[model samples]
Target: MSEAVQIASIKDDGAIPVYVARPAAAPKGAIIVIPEIFGVNPGIRQKCDKWAANGYLAVAPDIFWRFAAGVELDPDIEAQLNQAFGYFQQYDPADGVYDIESTIRWIRQDAGAIKVGCAGYCLGGRLAYMAAARTDVDASVGYYGVMIDTMLDEAHRIANPLMLHIACEDQFVSAQAQAAVHAGLDGHPRVTLYDYPGMPHGFAAEMGDRRHAAEAELADARTEAFLAEHLA
Candidate 1:
């Protein structure tokens, strides 16, 4: 099992809280785990632990720290979405990207880190794509990223390997939107896209009713393989 520790983020104003998981043995590399609309909740923390188990030092920065540090809203769609949306309305994606960039810089300074990659869910998935386009991480993976079809112009900027898992039946990311994304990124050398036939948004979340076991398992396996190839 990996141990979770609180780490300080590199920032101009003040330190932000980042949860890091280190493997029992030396790390093969490092990975940044971006959370969903909810902050660094149990699920996101578990992802950090999972990556650590997979041999990478994993870090999950509290991106919601700007609005409300350690804000972890409920996973219930009806109970939490309004609040999550409120936070989303207040949050800027660019700022989140900057925070991730800072986390990347932190990863670079780590003695155990020889290569760095990132993976994200929901809103984070979109940020993972942005990280691929903007940051210097070795690889990135995104799951059901929101509004990514609108940012197809940035596809060419991605030089590092990037994987995107799109939910075919996702209401948030409709079939048409997925097609647009495929149209723009289909032939990109560094971009790989995976489509889950009947899955909906948040398909990989343990707390959600939309979770699909088979698809999540397959996507995760692919993600690990992709990481192995690129972060090697």
Candidate 2:
């Protein structure tokens, strides 16, 4: 069992809903777990739970609430893909940074989170990078983040520790885009990127058919290790 709490985000001139998970015991630090474009669904909740199980306070904000609240899509492949694209059309990297910043502030004030980190998947993955670039989070991790090619210019602002997990077989983001992201890092000592073969996008999600349990476990271990290293 885990402890869950409702969090509020002050963005878009109003408040947005968020879910927070933590162990019954005190937490070591705070982590902002960004959800995919599908919104704050079950998968994201499970992620928060997993982090909590690892002894951290994990919070996931509904970035889509600014456009539509309580919006959830079907899990079918085609339907999910279509809905994800539609959601992405309404949100930009800037909006993501704004909403995540609000969540970070809220956690710092309400949860007494002394250290902050971030991790996201797919669309949320890109937003993690944006948060690392624009916010004061101590660290960030992005798993197969799309649209990284377009945000390369902002990489210079990413002064915190950053980790990126890329799928070698990803069809959406090309090799050129990956290269651009690497080049944009420009000798950032705190940043590291990894490419995993035979894994598809959203591989970290255990709820979907594409869930590679082995790869997901490996990624989760890496994430835990990264958080331990940076958040400590």
Candidate 3:
């Protein structure tokens, strides 16, 4: 139900390798899956598969292709963490937004998509928020997005539905940062924010040590239902 596809990146004119997943029947909608700093690893691919199984056309782009085209880093490896951060620091979010927008356009034209949303984990979580604010995406969901508080002012620009899952106990996101994110967008009519009481960063991702099945299931359920309602 999944295959690799190549898409053009406007920034470099290089092929951005994307993993595409198709549903057995006509899709209800489409979603662009954005991975953590770890690139399009197994967990991200599985997420795409899950979306496809849920009857949505799903694709996950290798946004880190700019530096490491197909990099998959182990979270437990110190060297890998350093390398991931190196790529993360070198990569620009604006360029990422463009790539995601490109993916959205591809979904729209090639898949005949009626409604399209985006979901991101970790670093991608922030990208999802930026995409919703800047692109034509119909909806977006972000899980434990890092550095989101710095860009909350852009929340006013979102025209479609957005759901954010904040891990309350996440070390990557401080208490003050979570409070800032909530204060900025919680009351917005188009935005919905949920707090996971004791979840950590990457809890929804099926990666080593960090995966929390119960919390992930609950959050994914909410994500699917939200996308269903907004993209229906």
lDDT (0-100) at residue 222 of candidate 3? 97
Using lDDT, give the best candidate's number.
3
Error of 3 at 22 (Å): 0.9
In the order shown, what is each candidate's alpha-carbon RMSD? 1.7, 1.9, 1.2
lDDT of 2: 0.82
The best-first sequence of candidates by TM-score reads 3, 1, 2
How do the residues 82-112 of candidate 1 rate in per-residue lDDT, one tens digit apiece? 8888888888898888888888887777644
lDDT tens string, model 2, 90-170? 886677788888888887897784798999988888999888888999999999999887988887788899999988777
lDDT of 3 by residue, 101-204 (tens): 88988888878947999999988999999998999899999999999999988988999999999999999899999999999998999999999998888888
Tell me the TM-score of each prediction against the true structure: 0.94, 0.92, 0.96
The CA lDDT of each predicted structure is 0.86, 0.82, 0.91
Once superposed on the true structure, which residue ranges of model 3 sit more than 4 Å away at CA? Answer: none
Can you list the residue pairs that collide in candidate 2?
Answer: none
> Where does the lowest 10-residue lDDT sum fall in candidate 1?
1-10
Candidate 1: lDDT of 12? 76
